[model samples]
Target: MKRTLTTFIATLALIALGAGARPAGAAGVTNAVAAAGTTNIVASSDGKFTPSTIVMHVGETTTLHLTSSGGVHGLVSNRLHIPLTRIQPGKAVNVAVTPSKAGTYVLPCAIFCGLNHANMKLTVIVKQ
Candidate 1:
């Protein structure tokens, strides 16, 4: 009886840990694509930026509407000319950006949220 109970508990613990484990290369994977002009970005306590990628044309202005669905977060990109922007729950912050060059810019979360913060990033693709 004792061995059976211990085995059951061990199996349960393994299942619980596996449930939170992500597949290899699954970090930062996003299927969402943001259009130009106006894009809405959502931050969460899970340390993720919704619509992880944004596509824009060079010389064209785009406004990023930043808001948090869970915890506080922030981002800043000097190459993209974006200033330090903070995102918090119950509030919205708008940032206007016009990419002069065409390239891919990866902006990581400026503020640390939690264990998954390193995987939190937004990819901006500027096209000529």
Candidate 2:
């Protein structure tokens, strides 16, 4: 009887340790999660998202600052993903996006900027 009790106790401890050792996200998004509005993403000198890409876990919101050194750009997404708002050249536009799904969403340029107008894109990394 004592031997059986000892074995049971050891098994429980092993199980507990294994569960604690596991990560939060099944996909392994272990980095610091950037909560909503934690940081603002800005467009690079070439009128592109500086970091260009963003990583976020499920159930989090974030703010993006799309700025252009020259020319006017708007946040254009499936729902006005262009610049957050209409800002003059050299100005920054703040846009908030809440990704309910785990996938890549594009932030296109709302305005007709010509030539490379279709190149504006933002990658939202959602951890499922």
Best candidate, lDDT-wise? 1
Candidate 2: give the clashing pairs: 36-61, 74-82, 74-83, 75-81, 75-82, 75-83, 76-81, 76-82, 77-80, 77-81
Query: How well is each residue in 1-128 modelled by candidate 1, as lDDT tens digits?
Result: 99999999999999977754632112223233455477878888898888788788899999887877678899999999999999887677889999999999999999888887999999999999
Candidate 2, residues 1-128: lDDT per residue as tens digits? 99999999999999988766542231132133445465444443355644567776555656654445446656555632333465344455566666667776666665655566677656766767
Clashing pairs in 1: none
**Which 10-residue window of candidate 1 scores lowest in summed lDDT?**
22-31
Error of 1 at 91 (Å): 1.1
**Residue 124 lDDT (model 2):** 67
Assess the local accuracy of residue 4 in candidate 1 as a C-alpha lDDT between 0 and 100.
100
Candidate 1: segments with Cα more than 4 A from true spot: 1-36
Quote model 2's TM-score: 0.53
